[model samples]
Target: MLRVIGKRLLLLVPTMIGLSILLFAWVRALPGGPAVALLGEKATPEAIERVNELYGFDRPWYEQYFIWAGRLLQGDFGTSIQTSRPVVDEFMRRFPATLELSFLALIIAVGIGVPLGYFAARRYGKVSDHASVILSLVGITIPVFFLAFILKFIFAVKLGWLPSDGRQSPRIDATHPTGFYVWDGIITGEFDAAWNAIVHLILPAVALATIPLAIIVRITRASVLEVQNADFVRTGKGKGVAPRTLRTRFIMRNALLPVVTTIGLQAGLLISGAVLTETVFAFPGIGSFLATAIFQRDFPVLQGFIIFIALAYALINLIVDVSYTLIDPRVRVQ
Candidate 1:
């Protein structure tokens, strides 16, 4: 297990190196360039040259990459071209809200998706199975923006059951020490702030959960269906084991590997999908942060964010791999 973990951690070095190269080149390839973006098209030639030189766009790609990479190694993510704030500081500030929302969505997805999928597979060819199939399909097909708008209209505008956007009500004056409003509110014994945070969270969390929920359901259903027909499951059934015990010990135990893999990958998807969901809902998070960065051609922020995301994705997959040994004792890590 230690060896497996060591190998995975080592691999991240080369993976991040490759990703940084791609990300650097990709950002430079954007039209109008950062120079034109910072200064309008009407800006004089000398001004553009100065801006290019200031950011080292005047240097060779490899040179620029090494320079930026060196700084990154020292934990300097550089300043945002748009906000003029340190990339790390800005990311840390916004990350909690995004984490808060994405986490709730994942919890909701797993809570509802796993059981529905397991039951659907168990009652294959029944009405519930058919309904699960349709629901998963619709969940996959619906645009998050459209769903978000509709949810906001129904829940926030018409029903007034939930706030449409923001992490808390503007009328509420609460300082989120940790940037996660509800958590900070709870720790500080400010129940009203905590309640407001949850109310504001519901719509966005539901909208963001759509894709991952569908994906988890589909994967769980397929895995469970396959496991249910295995020889062990058949033996358990023939022996008249209690239904719950049999399913838990044989069916679910065998079915979880692929579902775990799917769930781990979905974490990355949730972060990526937040760009659209956050934009539609106007929730202040990395998605909107990146969006604003792109419009202003803030290459530093973009590079920092993508590298951070790639690192996160790699780490999540590593966690999933480690979990395999724990979930199934038969699986051994090198």
Candidate 2:
């Protein structure tokens, strides 16, 4: 296991380098670069040239990449052109919100999706199974931004049961070491603040959970159904194994393998998908921050977010790979 992990980590280096090159080229391909974004199209030629030089945009592409890469290696993510804030600092500040939202969404997804899928497969060809199919279809079909608005309207605006947006109510001023507001509230023994943060999180989390919930439901149901007729499962039934033990040991354990993979993929997607959810809810997170960076032509922020998200995706895949052995002993040999 250790050797496998080491190998994967080694592979991450070249993968990241390739991604960086692609990212650098991709950002420049976007319409209206930093110079044009900073200085209007009608601005004087000298003014545009000054902005380009200030941001090293006047240099050759390879030189710009090397300089940026060198700074990144030294833990300097560079400064944002829009806010002039350190890119890394800004990412760090907003990431806690993303983490909070993603986690809540994942929890909701797994809590509902897994059980619903299990029961649906168990009751195949029945009303419950058909309902699950319909629900999952609806979930996948719904656009994120549209869902966010609907949820916000039903739960926040019409019901007034939750806040429309933001991480916390303005009334609470809880503080702690970790940037996670809910975590900070707990550690500081401020129950009210923690509860308030959760309240603020509910709508956005639900909105974010829609797609993943549908996916997990489909994956879990399929995996379970496939495993239900496996030779081992049939053999266990023939041996008069207790129903619960047979299902747990032979059915669920094996079925969970694919579900676990789906979950890891969904978790990585939350970072990218949060953009629409954050924008709709006006939630403060890296997704919305990245969106703002793009419109403002903040190359540093754009590059920093892309690299960070890619690195995160790689790490999540590595973790998922390592977990395969734990999920199924048959995979240990591979």
Write down the RMSD of all candidates, one decimal each: 1.3, 1.1
- What lDDT score belongs to each candidate, Candidate 1 first? 0.89, 0.92
Regions of candidate 1 where Cα sits further than 4 Å from its true position = none
Name the candidate that leads on TM-score: 2
TM-score of 1: 0.97
Clashing pairs in model 1, backbone N/Cα/C closer than 3 A:
none
Native-to-model Cα distance after best TM-score fit, residue 162 in candidate 1, in Å: 1.4
Clashing pairs in 2: none
Report the CA-based lDDT of candidate 1 relative to the real structure: 0.89
Mark the regions of model 2 whose C-alpha exceeds 4 Å error after superposition: none
